[model samples]
Target: MTDYEKFKIRHNVITLGKKEYDIAIDKFVRKALKNKDVVSIYKIGSIRYPGLSDIDLIVFLKDRPKHFSIKKFSIKNLSAKEKYMFMHEIFAVPDSMGGKIKLLYPIFSLEHLGGKKYDFIEPETSDFIPFFIQEYVKGYMSWPDRIIRKGIIDEREIIPQVYATKYSIGIYQKILGYSSKEFERKCRQYIKVAENLREDFYKTKKDERDKIIIDLIYLTKEINNAMFFDLKKYLDKNIKTKPRTITLYLGFRPNIVVFNKHIDYMEFLNIRFLPSNFSLICKKDLSGAFNDEKLEKAFEKRYKLIEQYDDFIYKNNLGRFMMLTNMKSQFNITSFIKKRVSKN
Candidate 1:
């Protein structure tokens, strides 16, 4: 089929798919407005995507007295299937919005909307809709800039598979015990596959974007494993102790065991690292953990975890770990540990 004909087919399918969704949303909005409590219905998420898979609806309700408020608001008045579809659109808002709303209000605070069904009251103090829309627009507008900023391409041209090959080789070195020869061969193969996948994605050949993302994520995990292993080796060689019990705490936990002497090790090395991209990590009991401290602790923890087990730090390394401690306090555990561990 011609490109125009293909586009028409896709557009028609999407339009037909959204009919029921649009009707449900429209009915909900009308009913909400009639109650004289709901002030607005802010549509978010893929509804705004040029090619949306599903609709997202965020209805803002007016605040009511606690005694009169419904505990669990929901669209139970609607048919069971309708309610199910609505719930799906409602739950994913936080993740889609980048979890920024959590900083302002408790997630449960909005529970009334889904909890009390048709008789729920809105939040007393929530400008989340406006903020959400603003942030969404900002991100949408910056998409072009962000893609270009990757430094891989100057303009919107198809990316070469060579980059993917390099990335794959890097992954092999970091994750697998592949020798130079093996790594080179695998990298070349990866590049060829990546090239084919890229073309497929652009041409809409067979929904290859998701496959590419999955493969890339796997490769990233492998790289992380390699880094952790290397760090573990370094620690074993440098730290002198029999049965030195080293615990690698992963996830958003504020705990670290370091030799006192290694307190100044990061500064001595003058290297900066990021623990996790999602949340901040701090030393336990310390108030304000510097970037460097977090970075060092992150590296140390990663190394320890990898040495201990392949999956020990998998969850933490998935970009959700947070350290909760102040590394800038007058406390001096670094020196103490260094002295103690050194003697062993």
Candidate 2:
């Protein structure tokens, strides 16, 4: 490959940028490719969309390590300025990025891939991306509490399947443009139905609301069924090739921020009702029950801190103070200047 072709866009996708750290990923990926034992490397999480917090990944290796030792590779380090920013093997989901520079949590799996030490073999799987999508649905049904657990956040695991309809939207637009009469008609009908019913999902009964907890476990089975019927059909038909090891690099910066847009509820459709029959989406009951004492305490602590910060910023008229800048020094420039003048 020539130097000119190295950074060129392919298939309308851009994968290189001006930041030093963003460039470093290309270098790291290149090095990983040279390894004989590396089976595959998948780029996942916020990096796939806009407003990227960090480049998250999952590696499928010939052998899996017993424990993963990972490094924090921030494009711009915010440890001194942010709470819990430097936890070992933990990517503190930035409340807001300090700037546009991308962050790379450089291959957490690499941490445990010591010099020639190997453990379990990497599992063989056919539907890699589909597995990711289905897992989110299952977690919503089975382990909703873990989704909100404090500390290291995993966007790959938690981003609701409903948000991914945007991708389906993109694909349908392509189908429409192709002049496929039957397919386009069906696509338009499905989208219209989705738009109409997205607003009016039935409310949970009073008895269901007063349970020990109102996590999304109740909504999961619905999501999973949708995943099988609606999502599976769309994906299989569109992504109609055996997958390969891919390094997903969104060369341009995505414009969404985690702090500005934290997920309030799980998003998915009543796929049981088809495109042929438009139906409403299932949402989490917002009036939550915190039966776990530990989780309740944790929520209160985070809630109070955020509440105080919001009040501080509202009174000060300062910019939205991210968790990244919350703990940074608030030094008085006037006082320092006066002290310097006295010394002179």
Candidate 3:
């Protein structure tokens, strides 16, 4: 069988009874293309993902004609709300020739239609135009290519799909922008928040620390919303944490940290009091449950330490302060030992 046939068969098997959805997409594209202003229609989202859910169709227009309207089309069985959603999606196409050609669409449509014009900030003879023009042109062209090839299209159909699929990539690049490094940095920040929450859980007394822990959990959700990337999906599929507490522990600090001077150890401390699992606090938790013997030993150790410093803490209301100091010391020493052993 041909590659396309094999792919179609494989996709059918994976999706089971959803083959009709794929067939419907092809029909929708053909229907959209019949309209005079419709230049092309590309299937995006789950339809392109083979076995994934949901289907998104990107209908591209050559120009925003005064006469053209999605509402005029007579596609059946769709509710008024669905029709409006579809029309909104079509109306979002960018106006610039380059943008139209690239076909970048995001959750929201592009607001600027008249091409990204370079402003003459200084004088007409300034050299900024050349640099701006060069950067814009490079971005305008390269973005569409990367999105089509890397982001969406399956490898086997790359040749047949290239022309039609170009718009998909263009839309994706415009939606995601072209900054993997910036994305990674933002992800790291959220992960740090998650790690901090986990650490706090382990260190704080459950009954006394509800307010701060709850706030940290809320902060994690806010970070997740702000980042709005796929890191949450990674956390969901790979890790186990309560939905309420997900924001808190989704990207907890690395289970182990290699000691390095450049590391932001202070930031780690600031977030460390947020709470976490026993495994994060005690290395021995990795093996199994804390036995009677281990619990007795731990209590004895704690009693001795409390006996040694209880008077000072009571006099100063330094209970929380002492706990934090002890937590930091343990973390640093464990981190140092781990690094030393890893090197050897």
Q: Which candidate number would show the highest lDDT if scored against the true structure? A: 1
lDDT of 1 by residue, 48-69 (tens): 2111233345544333212111
Give candidate 3 regions above 4 Å deviation.
1-17, 46-52, 64-67, 74-222, 225-344
Q: Please provide, for model 3 over 1-344, each residue's C-alpha lDDT reduced to its tens digit, 9 standing for 90 to 100.
A: 11221121111112223455546555555565666655544443343233323344544444443333535443334554333222223322312232222211122222221213322122111122211111222222232234323333332222122222233233323333434676445445534543443334345553333333333333333333332334234224433332221122222322221112223545345334433211122222212222334432432333333233334333433333212112111244346545655776
Cα RMSD for candidates in order: 17.8, 23.2, 26.7
User: What's the best-to-worst order under TM-score?
Assistant: 1, 3, 2
- Model 2, residue pairs in steric clash: 50-254, 51-254, 51-255, 51-256, 69-111, 141-220
The number of the candidate with the highest TM-score is: 1
Q: Is candidate 2 or candidate 3 better by TM-score?
A: 3
lDDT value, residue 234 of candidate 1? 38
Alpha-carbon lDDT, every model: 0.34, 0.29, 0.32
Instruction: Give, for candidate 1, the lowest lDDT window spanning 10 residues.
Output: 318-327
User: How do all the candidates rank in terms of lDDT, highest first?
Assistant: 1, 3, 2
**Global fold similarity of model 2 (TM-score):** 0.23
Q: Report the error of model 3 at residue 250, Å.
A: 25
